[model samples]
Target: MRFYPATLSRLLAVAALAFSPLSWAEQAISDGVYEIHYNAFNSSFITPEVAQQNGLMRSKYRALVNVSVLKLQDDGSKQAVTAIVSGQAANLIGQAQQLEFKKIDEGKALYYIGGFRFTEDEQLKISLSVQPDPNKPAYNIEFDQRFYVD
Candidate 1:
């Protein structure tokens, strides 16, 4: 998991000791210079303290989306960079909900997270727009995710 924030690991954890299918599945994308990593999972797995401190909704029906941007340097090292990330999630039935992102800043490391509601066994199509830098073109990515409520 390529998380920028120090407390992100504590926030995004698998429900069980094993790697369940519904675990945090982080994915990455790049346009040569910029790398964007993102993932979405049920918010209930996060501890109450972590959730409260981060203003995350910790309910079975709530889900959170995490996104981080990195810039590739000439030395082949990735540097965390701030970016504007916004998106929306739409269910299979075409019900769309806008995602309001909250920036979590941790010194040099920072990331954007958004929360949305989901139903049991609900599958949603997530669409995101990432702009790591104004000089570069904006990145758009989409994926489908299924959420289960315990």
Candidate 2:
């Protein structure tokens, strides 16, 4: 099972995982050269076989976070770019959780996947910092989402 962020996004969307379209309204941060798409949803949306093949724990109580970086080419196309990503999730009650992302690189596509457990009615604020390369500046992104196991 190849862990492509776009592929996972489409699968999660079909499974009612609350995935937003790839528009500007979604959690996208761009630095004129690179754009990052951030997606998080309930892990129950993924099939057990796919989850197992991708090294993800298949549980309704788990949330999967994915990030993809794209570099805009001069010829009007987007290219997947690799980056170092790190982030954390926190609740309103001061409960903090760190995100340990596993990087996957397939050809020109790169993605970071991470999982965390959450309660049925809790909201988590996620923050991520991505550095595309040694010469580029880091991009910091912040967003809030609530996960429900039921």
Clashing pairs in 1: none
All candidates: TM-score: 0.85, 0.84
Question: Worst 10-residue stretch by lDDT in candidate 2?
Answer: 15-24
Off by over 4 Å in 2: 1-9, 12-24
Clashes of 2: 0
True-structure lDDT of candidate 2: 0.77
lDDT of each: 0.79, 0.77
User: Model 2, range 1-150, lDDT digits (tens) per residue?
Assistant: 555555654564454334422223556777788889887877887877667766887787888788889998999789998888888989998787899888766566777888888998778888888888868678888888877774
| Candidate 1 off by > 4 Å | 1-5, 13-26
lDDT of 1 by residue, 9-105 (tens): 5455343222235344547788778889877877787778777777878898988888888899999998889998899999998999999999987
